[model samples]
Target: MATERPGASDGGATPQEGARTAQQIAGELRSRIDRGVYRVGQLLPTQRELGADFGVSRDSIQRAMRDLQTEGWIESRQGSGSRVIRARRIHTPKARAGQPAPISLGPLISEAFEAEEVSLDACCLTAEALTDHVGVQADRVARGEVNPRSISLRLLLPSTEPKPAFPAAADDPGDTRPYERWAAMVEFHTGRLRDRLLALQRGKFVSDVDVKVRRAPVTPTHKLYLFNGSSALHGLYVVETRAMPLSDGTEVEALDILGLQSTLFHFEKTAFERARLIHNSLVQKVK
Candidate 1:
């Protein structure tokens, strides 16, 4: 009587069942890899050995190895047997230090503002930067800095308000009143947004803002704003652009800020949640 191999089962199957047998063997091998029974860079058993173990033909074992190779789980060398490859790491986006700060557009809109000759793209991008800035500021606060409060917010429909237009497209055009009104709006919204985000960051309360931009562009632009007490945090904002686009050339711009406001708010409440989680995990490991 011969000794049974590692993958051998009691029942004897026919050659017609070879494909199924090979698949079963492959699955077992994969399971071993997943469970860490077979470590990366470890050579798998020879075809003959695996065939004997699984009570299958050497040809069947070869087929399974080919499958594993095609799937990128293992690589084969002429002199060296098949070796397992470490799995690829997942890709994630994160904030970088010493880079241009994120921008937010939440504060740029006047209650009843207007503009002309401004490219839709410029307006949209600016709005997005504002919201992104808010997120950045919130991150700073989380690190125990003297940063403004910021929150992740979504703008809902009907409550959406359009951005008022600016007089002209001059780069640093010095019209005081429009600029002042614009600055005031930015301050008001930034302060509100920042406070809400800080509350969420400090675990004080869970709050959200819904910003709706109407008549501006087909696509809605989003922004994050920071508030320091009653004042808006200077130069800290973040913006995210929405995917859906309204019909082209629509003249209306609207923004409606909405969401839950309370200490129960968690940082995991926004798009940056996963990145934040990864960053926290890495930091913990370093410590």
Candidate 2:
């Protein structure tokens, strides 16, 4: 697989709207990369093409591309356009039984949504990536591509009131900027996720919808996602000390984790564990 060049970016050509567009386009592209829709070493559509497809300006595309590059997802060149660098990742010690292909969270989530009753439980620091993937499935339900009678979600998040172990000031731990920034992200992404799920119920598409998000007082070192009480995806967070830019145009030394890059381990109730119950919340008992 090809690797992105070190310290390569779009030369900071992001326009005034770059801030908003960075999240908008980068998220969509990120989801695609995660799902393996765009494989490693494959050149993504040119900025002109992506702008037309996504109905955004070329400047916004540039900004989004830069964000992707910074995240180690893609790399861009002067004329060759941007290409995916790290999409699918492999880890050892555990593998899905009888499955030849690598498991993707996208497909598993899609499968759950296809059932008459869909249940999801996730424990994570933020719902940013989950929100992105769920957005795609919601669009499917809206378009009548797949119809499910109900949807249920239980999301466990860290309490916003406490200062987290991550996204903290590296030089001075007392700086509250990181905590404030983390709070804003939790509000924005989780709120959006809740609203999107409820909208399906209001539209009368899904006959029933239950979304319960709880705040856990402690920070979790690993993220866990349970799909329909049958399978679980777990990934451990790796913390790093880096410089984070604040909204006020100043940089701060910070400690953070890149959740997207973490390797996930898949476990099944029947194949992986012998325990009688896989998830206590839903009471998924193994046969």
Q: Largest lDDT belongs to which candidate?
A: 2
The most accurate candidate by TM-score is: 2
In candidate 1, position 68 carries an lDDT of 75
Per-candidate TM-scores read: 0.28, 0.63
Give the per-residue lDDT of model 1 (tens digit) for 1-287: 22333334745445656666667778888888767787655678888788777766687788788887766566676776777653221111233585433221222221001221111111221232333334433433444533222233332211113333331123334433433334355455545545645465456422332333423322223222322211121221122222222234322222222111101110113447656878999999999
Off by over 4 Å in 1: 1-16, 87-287
Q: Candidate 2 clashing pairs?
A: none
In lDDT terms, how accurate is model 1? 0.42
lDDT tens digits by residue: candidate 2, 1-287: 11222222654334444566557788888889878788655789988898777766677778788887755566576876776655643233345687433244555676678888889999998887677667667866886968989899999999875666877888887898977888888899889889988999999989999999999778779888899888888888878887877889988888887675567777777743545343552564432
Error of 1 at 165 (Å): 39
Candidate 2 residue spans exceeding 4 A from truth: 1-102, 271-287
lDDT scores in order: 0.42, 0.75
